[model samples]
Target chain A: MKARLIIVVIVLALMMVVMLVPIPYLSKPRTHHITLDSQRYEYDPGRLEVHQGDTVIIDFTASDVVHGFYLEGYGIETRVEPGLTKRIEFVADKPGKFRFRCSVTCGSMHPFMIGELVVGPNTTLYRAAATMLIGIAGTLIYLWSFKGEQHE
Target chain B: MTKIDLLTAAPWLKPILRSRLFQPVLMLATLAFFVMVILTGLFGTPAGNRNFGIVFVWIVWWALLMIIMVPFMGRIWCTMCPIPAPGEWLQRRGIVKRTSGKLSTLRWRFPKRFRNMWLQNIGFLGVAIFSAIILTHPDVTAFVLLGFILTGIVLSILYENRVFCRYVCPVGGFIGLYSMMAPLEVRVKDPSVCVTHTPKDCIIGNEQGYGCPWMLYPGGMQRNTYCGMCMECVKTCTQNNIVINVRSIGSDLTVAKERRLDEAYKAFIMLGCAILYSAVLLGPWGWMKDWASMESVANWLIYAAGFLFINLVVLPGAFALTTGLTRRLSKQTLSTRELFTHYAYVLVPLGLAAWIAFSFGFALVNGSYALVVLSDPFGFGWDLFGTRDTAWQPVGTTLIPFLQTGILTAGLLFAINTAYKIAAQYSQTHRQAFIATLPVTGFMTMVTFILLGLYLG
Candidate 1:
């Protein structure tokens, strides 16, 4: 019984740690360079992670047809054609995960053409993770408690 | 199997339900919208968010189906589905009421081997594999819709009584699975009444209405998995025994004998698909999106293999392991196969919640685009409603994470509760039951965590 209790605590602690670990965002804004390559329907390095107060410079190039890179929440959207590079510069003032998708109709699977820009101090992700852990914990506690109360 | 009759409470709904014109009329109206969506698909703007077909079908109608219809009303959409309407009308040889003459086609029996959910499962996977294309491109969407209608018509001509819907429609597969949780059901008022009542008009049909289109015997129907809610059973019952009931959600989940491997696999596939969809469509996984969208034939093949393997083998394998553990831990005398199948039902609520949660990510993000598309359906620069140029604004963008967390939490709770209840079935001792539930709960919790990482990470 003692071993089981210890195991349970360890499991809860590990889960809580995964769900509640804080991200350290740089206080000062720094300029970062990112190269994004687009093929039939995807962007290379599909995820770009940065601190909240960073300046992002992205060199977007298309390997095939004309593709539009429309970033949600950042108000930065551009069209990059084959053999031509579209350079965009924007400040990462936000702290969340935002999708940057192909706005142009490239082909059959054009609408699903998407990428992500994740800025740090991403609290919602942590909140959501914590909520899920809590959900599991809450339900288990209730079921166990209910069973105990019934004395069956 | 226990149900409370809605007719006993409302009483007046019987007339509306009995009227043969009601269902077809609703079908006709939806048909207009359906045709309009198809037309827009063929001649609309190339941009998906701006086009009516993609917006309305994927975002609007999809949202309604996941968040409302399937959750609240069992097989309600099947009652007035436009895909099977024209063929069904032609088969009956009339639009509104039952016609006197024979149906206008060759009526052959659908093969017995293909009658199971296996075909529907395959059909759903076939469409799901190309979902990035089907859910996006207007031409593809239009063609898919047209294909379904034509298939329905051809099946109606070749076979008898909605073989297309009962055994073929891809959408019906998931809807049928989740519709088990819906509060609304059409069942016999008393099974005794139908058992003794010989020469059943509900099965053979009378002048009042046609035989069951969904190919279900209303008498022994304990679950809403197959019943299409067409009211044909209600209309044709000479003894007036068929009654629609407003009962508790998921009352069918506990039905033991009605469970099947096909339906259980469907639960796994749906849950897996929901997780994968969240990752590819809503997650930060671009390479996965590329592979899923068939960026190349090779990449697509790999993605398809992984997708199938995960859905068919991985999820089920993991679940079977968990169920096996539960059985072992409980010291139960029941067969492991029975326990596995029954435990799979626990994922139904979780799957439904996952789909709804995953939907909110895109549905809310792109939901506002529906308004713009509605105003300019054809996208020929026509602003019929003057809202054509509505800017791309994601509704509830800030609230999505919270909403998702809350929804996921609710789903987990339901699943855990279901797990405990299922464990209770095999275990006589409360201690044994609690021991049985522990591993499954852990597995479910881990599943929720994966969803969290996908949606919230």
Candidate 2:
């Protein structure tokens, strides 16, 4: 039982370390100019990726109707009408995944019109994946620690 | 450890359960909201975000159901669900005050072959296929809800109690499946007391309450899957044998004898739908959303076919291979079919967690609309609650990834633990059990990775 307890402590400590310790990235920040197309219920280039200190310059256009872009965690909001190009620029300092949604009540599916912006390296996803693996392994070892006693 | 009966733990609960006004009052209260939801769906704005039906039913109610009610309270929602209330009240000939007579129904028996969850599985899939439309279109939501109530009434007229809920309600299917993992359960406190009691009043209604509306005998009920937690048995148990207990979660998943293929399929369908819904609604996939939203009939047809194939064939076929590998590794004596059904129990917690995580993705983001819609239910610019001008804001956006990670990790761990317990049930030795669990654990781990990829990738 003491050995099992020690194993559990070791596994949990390892998981915490993997989750909390930040990893260094070598990619230098750069600027990217992109045209983001907006339509009825979706966005062109629905996914955006950039380095942690990169500058993102978007020439946003709405095709079929009026649309609004609101990026979570960045506090960037813009409105674009048909035949008009809205320019928005921002620095990607927060390094994680954030969702950009249609702010205007466009149509029946307006609430779900969503896109993602990832500022790499996406350490959260990696850490989460690793945590899942370690958690599963720890659970299996704990389950195996029991003698062949009938549970019922 | 022995379970804590809530009635014994808190003596006040028994009186509340035994009151004839209990279920009816709860149903009437929710029925008011149900009526408003349908009314708004029929006459509200076409934009889903500004509409009460879309915001309340899909975001607010679904969040509460997935995150709170199903996990903590078992089938407590069924006790207060207003869909079958009108039909049941008509059958009983009164509401709140019990009527002293046989229920006015045709009393035709439900078909024996259809007694299980197969119809519900099919019904849920049918609704799920058109969910993108039904969820967005107010009129469609209203019509679907109307269809459910009408079917309940018709079933009540044709058959005995709650055949629609027990056999056909689409939402009830997954709710019942996941309710097995809830800490709450309705059970008989003592088998000896039930056995010695004469004239089981719980089955035959006394003046206090009607018989089990879920068509379950409290004496024989071993799981929360079918027991609706309606408290009827509590009202009518002369020996007071029936008690609502707060036990450890997932206790029913180990009831190996009650496992069934139909329920196993329900697990797969729910998990598949959660993943697909996350990818389509929450993921950055425009074409997938277009297909799901029925951009064209042909596109929709392709989407429907693919959806059904994945839910019915791909997920189950993969799990079957995992079970086969477990059987081969452990040399367990059980047949492959039995192993498949037994092993499917692990998915209950994982599927519920996936849904909770998926709900968090959209629910918190859109939940602000609930306030706006409450003030302007019809979106006709009438600010009844003085909050119509409130701006749309996504809540808890930063916390979502962390929440999803914690939930999915917990689910994967629980699923692996369940896999080991199930393997132990069939294996002669602990080593063999651990070996048998590895394959299924690997499958669940892969599923967790896919879900995490969708949520965080």
Candidate 3:
């Protein structure tokens, strides 16, 4: 009985270890190739979504005047002049949405030049959207079910 | 200004707010800036970011108007607005004081049919259609401002007492609509006092001040929709009846008798514009931007048609359908038109919120440009404040999405609350009210999602 109890304790400890450990490398690493265009304070394919353990290869071009790609969270910023392509590769280690904005001063709308690099599963946006949907559902249910104020 | 009974909470504030010089003083200060805007637009650098006119008007003043003036001060900007200043002075034949003997004008009666916000709506739509040109081109911006002043003058000649601002002036229309949500209001301290007092000095000029320039009687006004906050009534009131009261936000939305189709359409147009502005200006669609920027005359025509259609048809149609569904499902018996008009108030808070969110995108990032522009108002290499060389720095870029999300969410909730309240006001029972709000709730959620997709996508 004591030996069985010891075996159970060891198994439980091992299970906790498995649960807590982050085996990101074990999951798999894949590379994603994306082409992005920056023009007049906007980006083509403004959203880039990838998994946590994927490599992201971005081929960027500025169709208009000089523009930029300043990726937050990864500290990779590039200045792409018009008619030139800049290639950038980075590991998708972070599983969240990070904005890639124009680093170079573009034009009047330059400051607004921004795009999104979303590493999946982008649970934050999903959760926010879910919460909004839930709010609607909850409001409907509350209104439909609850009896209103009695006029005095 | 009617229905007020409370005492002056801030007696010290009275003298400051009521002084005859106060509003004019404010106007002069802003007029100086306005002059600079015109000058910069005429002669400044061609670059919009570097130009004082674009930076100040679109980026700086717009930010203040959204975040501060409309939310806190109500028609305070109207009090100091430079658009109608030249026309008004020409009408009164003076800059500061009331001038006796029939005011200068052609004294033409403003057409009654055109008194509503319809003209303002058309004017705003006209401006918004060419927003890309007007927003970016300093020359265009100058011409637009000049056009407003010219219109104001022409109307002053044809009519009396700020007829342009009241019946026309697209900016005034927007301000008046949003002013309903402001916490501050200028109202009579007691309606009885105004009634008991003879001559109705507040409505007709006295030695102290001119009559209400916006053509509102201080004793009968209820909502903060039309009072331009000129404080002319305050100066003219011998009974000291006028008092600016600080109250809860959105108290004016509950004023049911004041609701109308014109205002409802204004709500739709504003909301549609906000949504479209977010999508076209901030969204990832380059072709859409191209269309708005007038890349081609055909594309612009298509864009303009689409713009007007979305605003006039798509949004209102969807809302009417929602209201209809709500009534059908809830088994409530009410006029469909009235319901449509009533529920339009739900969009007020949400519209402002959407605008605030949309403004946050460029305003935060481009706000820093104002510094450089100010030092060099004409961008003629004149750094007056020693900040013209201030580097272009986008402040708070990282937090923009979160801000947009939070604001949109708040706006959604506020809209839901407003819908429920309107329902309650219309219905006989709370249950019926809740049922009425259900469809509205769904509709509000959808609108919020559309905004979120534009901002967060």
Candidate 4:
């Protein structure tokens, strides 16, 4: 029982350390020119993936109706009209998934019209997944230690 | 492992629970909110963000239900639910005081075949398929709520005692299923006392209260699955045998004998819905939303067919295969079907966590809308509370991913524990149980990975 408790404590401490540690990224940052198309309730490129120091310049166009591009965590908002182009540029400094939603109510499902921008390295996802693996391993170890103790 | 009777722990609580006015007062309070929701839904602007009905029901009430009430208090919402209030009152013919010697109803017996959660499973699917529309349109929200109340009233007039909630209501089914995880349960202090007493006042009506309006006998009750916690049994128990005890959370999941396939299917459906809802609603896929919201009839038909298929067939088939592996690995003589039913209980905590994680994503982001809608309920520029013009601000955007990660991880740990405990019930040796738990652990781990991927990136 004492050993099992110690194992549990060690697993939890490992998870916390993994969660708090920052990962080193080796990819060189570059400027990327991307085109974003907007329709009634969707963005054409629904996801944008860029390195942490990359400069992202987007030429956003609305094909069907008027739409607003409000990117979370970046504080960038632009309005695109049909038959016109709206340019938005920002530095990919924040290294996490940020949602870009339609600020204007376009239709019934307008509130849910969303797109995602992922800035690498996505340390959060990696850490979470690693923590989950550690948790399961710890649990199995703890349960395996309970052999012959059930009848005690 | 330890039972603390809340009635004994807090003596002041017993009288409040036993009062005839308690349930009614709660019902009336929520009824007032219900009426406001309906009225605002009918008369309010088409913008769901500015409407009281949409913000309150989907954001505020949903957060409360998923995050707090269901986890901690069990079916306490059922105790105060206003949907069945009018029907029950009409049957009793009075509100504050008990006036009916017999309930005014036709007393038609609900068919025995329809007693399980099959109807609720189907009904929830029926509503869920149209959630994109029902969630956004205030008029549609109003109509659906109206439909629920009307069905409740019609059922109440035709039968006796909360048949609507027990068998037919869509929301009530999952609440009852997940209520198993709640720490609080209303049960008998001593079954021998109930047996020795002749009147069985908990089952039959006495002057103090109507008999268990959920139509369950308090003495024979073992799980929190169908007990609505209306406190009627508390009021009517002649020997003071009924007690609301605070027991260990998820204790009912270990009761292997009461496991049934219908409930197993419910767990599958809930987990499947949570996954699909996250992908469709929160995922960066507009075409999926277009199909779900019924931009075209053909697209919606395709989406609905796929939705039903994944929920009813694909998810369950996968889990059944996992359970089959568990049975074979453990060398258990128990049938695969039995193992499947018993092991589905493991999904309750993870399913709930998936829902909470999903809710935190939107409800907190959209929660500020509740305040705006409260002041200007109809969105006609009526500032009743003088705070109608509050701007839209998404709270805790930086903290949400961490919260989601923690919740999903905790849920996975709980699910693994539950899986081991359930496996132990079928195994003679601890090694056998550990072997049996591996396959299910792998399945749950995969599910957690999927949810984490969606939330994180």
DockQ, cand. 3: 0.23
Tens digits of per-residue lDDT for model 3, B279-333: 7776656677778878789999999999999999999999999999988987778
CAPRI-style grade of the A/B interface in model 4:
medium
Show pairs that collide, candidate 4. Answer: none
- Model 1 chain B lDDT-worst window of ten: B392-401
Per-residue lDDT of B269-303 in model 4, one digit per residue for the tens?
99999999999999889889989999899999999
Which parts of model 3 are misplaced by more than 4 Å? A1-29, A39-42, A72-76, A83-99, A103-114, A133-148, B1-7
Arrange candidates by TM-score, descending. Answer: 2, 4, 3, 1
DockQ of candidate 4 (2 decimals)? 0.70
- TM per candidate comes to 0.87, 0.98, 0.90, 0.97
lDDT (10s digit) by residue, model 2, range A70-131: 99988899899999999999999888889899999888788788888998888889899888
Candidate 2 backbone collisions, by pair = none
- Tell me how far the alpha carbon of residue B185 in candidate 4 is from the true structure, in angstroms, after superposition: 1.4
What is the C-alpha lDDT profile of model 2 across B273-331, one tens digit per residue?
Answer: 99999988888888888898999999999999999999999999999999999999899
> Positional deviation of A47 in candidate 3, in angstroms?
3.3
Q: lDDT (0-100) at residue B257 of candidate 1?
A: 78
Candidate 1 Cα errors over 4 Å, as ranges: A1-40, A52-95, A102-110, A146-152, B1-5, B43-47, B101-107, B238-240
In candidate 1, what are the lDDT values of residues B343-401, reduced to their tens digit? 88889998999988988888876777787887888778878888988876656665676
The DockQ figures for the candidates are 0.36, 0.73, 0.23, 0.70
List the global CA lDDT of all models.
Answer: 0.82, 0.90, 0.81, 0.90
